[model samples]
Target: MSLYQLVYYSRNAIAGDASVFEAEVDAILAASRRNNEAAGITGALLFNAGVFAQVLEGPLAAVEATFERIQQDERHGDVSLLALEPIAQRSFSNWAMGFVGHSAENAQRFAAIGLTRGFDPARLGGHKMHAILRDLTLEEEAAAA
Candidate 1:
């Protein structure tokens, strides 16, 4: 089976209550992990400043199906597909669905790692968006190790 990867970003539509957003985020990530694992998919999720950037990799059909499901998801507003291409191998093979929340420290860390100021994907272009997320994930792995 050919391996494929999909990258995208979206805005959080979970508004009104802080508790509600938090609960929704938790449920979302949990369900993502479960679903991805069952489908043999791997990916990482980064949420910063109410924006989300993610990369999903796996079988062509599985990744495409997940992308379709995400498009219909109400929790994710204004979803933008960044990239979808065949890949020889997985960059996030270790994660079923790793998630990271936004923070000043993280923004600073990412900026220091070469992402442009603000780290907004819509402003970064697709190629640059993929680069930033890829580097950030590597940096985080280094830090964790």
Candidate 2:
């Protein structure tokens, strides 16, 4: 199978209070894990109050199909595709859908990436976004261990 990687970002469109937002995100993650696992997709999602950035890697057709569903989802708006290309292998092979929320530690790390106001996925390139998600998700995995 030809492996492909896709990077994208979208504005947060889920309307709700803090708790509601959390619940919505939790639900999204649950669904993502189930569907991604079934489709043999592996990736990480980085989310905050303002934006969401994600990396998806898998077979070309599967990646495209998954992205199409994401585009049609109501929870996301202004979705922008940053990159989509063939890859040698998956960077997030261990995770069906690893999630990284905007905790204090993650916020600090994101600031170090050169964003002052907030986590602005629009200012980043696909490769940089992918690397940031990979590193943050690895840290999250280690902390959970």
Candidate 3:
């Protein structure tokens, strides 16, 4: 079966403070893991600064359907669809919905991904956005390993 990848970024609905934001993120990851596991979706979700960037890869229909629901989700606004097309394989296959939390030192830690300029999904192009997401996801995997 052909695979599809959907990448997007949006402003966080609970961005004013850290405590609420962390709680919201935990809830999102838990729900996403449950849902994505059932749907056979493999992807990564990144929470950095005040934005959410995610990459969902799976069957064409499944990926598209999931993206539609994400678009309709109220917690996400100013959504920018970075990349949405076929892919040869899943970059996040080991995860139902892997997550990466950002901190003050994250920028320096992830500077190899060209994040030294800061992660601005709005200004970054599709290729660069995908690169960042891939790096973040792999970084998480490496950390776990």
Least accurate 10 contiguous residues by lDDT in model 1: 110-119
How much is 4 displaced in model 2, in angstroms? Answer: 0.1
lDDT of 1 by residue, 1-145 (tens): 8999888999888777877877988998899999999999998887776788888999999999998998899987999988899999988877888776656678676557544345568766666766666777776788899
Candidate 3 — which residues are off by over 4 angstroms? 110-119
Could you tell me every candidate's TM-score relative to the true structure? Answer: 0.85, 0.93, 0.87
- On residues 22-62, what C-alpha lDDT tens digit does candidate 3 reach at each position? 78778888888888998989988877666788889999888
Candidates sorted by TM-score, best first: 2, 3, 1
Against the true structure, candidate 2 reaches a TM-score of 0.93
Clashing pairs in 2: none
lDDT of 1 at 22: 79
Better of 1 and 2 by TM-score: 2
lDDT of 1 at 121: 80
The better candidate by TM-score, 2 or 3, is: 2
The number of the candidate with the highest TM-score is 2
